[model samples]
Target: MEALSEVKLGPCRDSPYLRPLRIHYTQNGTRKHWDFMQTHDSVSILIFNTTRQSFVLVKQFRPAVYMCECARRGIMPTVDTASKDCSPQSLVAGELLPASAGVTYELCAGIVDKSDLSLQEIAKEEVLEECGYNVSVGNLQKITSYRPRWLQQEGTEAYRRGTNRHTPTVCAGEPSAADYWAAGGECRGHRRS
Candidate 1:
């Protein structure tokens, strides 16, 4: 996995992936507000390797998870902190958490930003790009769909089931695959218990 060093944090001025917004509404004759982020719907695939009796998973470092761990450990500012400046120097100066704190194992997934492709197609592409496995769209079984109560307002997440019949061929040549590897991310199989 990628090692974290010289970490820095700052305000997100603009992002194509997500937009933060607050909604004002009247509930039970009382006015209330809810803050959330508008993001593209996404798809996640659970890849099972029948040959190896394992699950294919991706391991990567998540900055958000790292920051949360830091805040929980009292080494960084919490989300409710009054100060908005989140520069590295503004955080607990000289204190740093191990990179392992941010490492996470996750299912192969991707955001649904393309308007032309179906959810199954997106899942197939994600499985190939992230997990280095070529899977047909027809083989992707839609398990269920749900919306997370977090910052994902109105964004639906679809989970699909995929089976890997052969060994993974890492597509390191693909731009997306290369980018993930360049950032110290990796794909591996976890034996099922």
Candidate 2:
């Protein structure tokens, strides 16, 4: 993975990945302007290594997720502290983070923009880019599509956190594929749609 120079986004709200959006519409017979996120739609490839009964997952530090974790745990980042490099080794070489600020296990995913490629093609690219396993578009099948709308950060009043909905009610240690299936979070086998 190519490591880019560490760039601090001013005070957090000025993130380059996010842009403020204005939506004007009528609600309850009144015209109002609401702020919304114009973020790109995303796709995920939930790869299950059936032979090994394990899922191919990626563990990385998502600064956004890390921010919410910090707020939930009342931990703050020191101004001068920044991760020089986000690699596994360099990630831990900075000021100590809260216990909640740990890596997250997620499927290979990417935004559905930047190209006219279909979702299947995008999924294959993510699998290769994030998991290092080249996948063919023919073999890549689409499954459930999700919005992940629950993931909210400190934003405008319209998008502020309503509750601790992002927090998982139960924290389980790394589980097997079976465990994941039982929890309604995993697909036992790959089934093309």
Candidate 3:
């Protein structure tokens, strides 16, 4: 069985778009490694109050997503994002290069845990807590799930460990991207009350 034991911080670096972290750990049979360098796992959902056509959108700032805003604006040139070697002069100025550094618009989300609940259940709970609406689990639809590909590059510490570990990606692109499904039993009664 593959079991992870103890983790120690090795190296850390950041850019406007990504935060790279290196954690050393022992796993599996012999001495192994576990990397959590640039990984993201999240959940998003949609809730409908059919009575109102307008939908609820959660506004939040994601450090990884927003770090690119400065670069996108051209205020922080591309070289600033690609350069890994920092000169002694640059360090004297007390400047740090990052992947992205701005406020980003994102759906309501939270990380999934290995508890009794499933990922679907976690999604429903987050939607209700963030948007204040009850959602049907069976009606949940999967959107897009992925790990960003911009983390790997020369001179960057984005990739963690030996590059074998995989991160879990769970989101339907955006929170509003998912369609709402109402379960049966009291369609007319729910609207009336």
Candidate 4:
């Protein structure tokens, strides 16, 4: 006979955006439990330009990752979020690395929620917001549905979901006019009117 295991999950704290939870399961007939964070499904866009032969990405400061790094180096602790209120996110206020170290380079991405817009439409919007690319949803080619690493790291929700990514495109508009694509350097363009 094969052994089986049952898993139980419940929220530990109430947050408007995210729900951190406690998960209990059976492993080799032994009961085990883990704490994690849960969030809505999301989409990521890969903005690459063929004319410039470059990829567009974003840089943002992530508190959780930085706090964890600090904790690892004995600089500080991860702020036992599982125990205290995780709602404010002010818990990670411990000594953290410089802002430069916390900044991460990432692709254009956003959470999926607006019911009116289609998945492709959402991807188009994210590309525009994060990468400043004005392109139509039709122009976006479906690449694959990928769960972001940070999302997975926060918690392992049993909910099966997919995040659509657009395939590579030469240029949504005039190739020469696009601002983001650089031959082999950083993109200085931000918040274009």
Best by lDDT: 1
Cα deviation of 36, candidate 1, in Å? 1.9
lDDT by residue (tens digit), candidate 1, 75-133: 76434334566443445546888878987887777787888987778887777666666
Model 4's lDDT to the true fold? 0.53
Query: Which candidate do you rate higher for TM-score, 3 or 4?
Result: 4
Candidate 2, lDDT over the whole model: 0.51
Best by TM-score: 1
lDDT tens digits by residue: candidate 3, 1-193: 1122221111235544234555666667567545453433556654434455444555543433533553454433233323466321211112333322433334556566546777677877666555544566665566656655644544445543334234444533223324333441123212111
Q: RMSD to native for every prediction?
A: 9.8, 11.0, 13.8, 12.2
After the best TM-score superposition of candidate 2, give how far the Cα of residue 143 lies from its true spot, in angstroms: 1.6
Could you give candidate 2's per-residue lDDT for residues 1-193 as a string of tens digits?
Answer: 1132332333334444455567689999999876655455667777765546666777665767665665565544344325543322232224435433545777666776756787777776666566555556776766555434545545734346233222111111222334233312223222111
Candidate 3 accuracy as lDDT: 0.44
Ranking by TM-score: 1, 4, 2, 3
Q: What are the TM-scores, per candidate, against the unseen true structure?
A: 0.67, 0.57, 0.41, 0.57
Off by over 4 Å in 2: 1-16, 26-31, 77-100, 146-193
| Cα deviation of 126, candidate 2, in Å | 0.8
Local lDDT at 166 for model 2: 21
- Work out candidate 1's RMSD over C-alphas: 9.8
Separate clash counts for every candidate: 0, 0, 11, 0
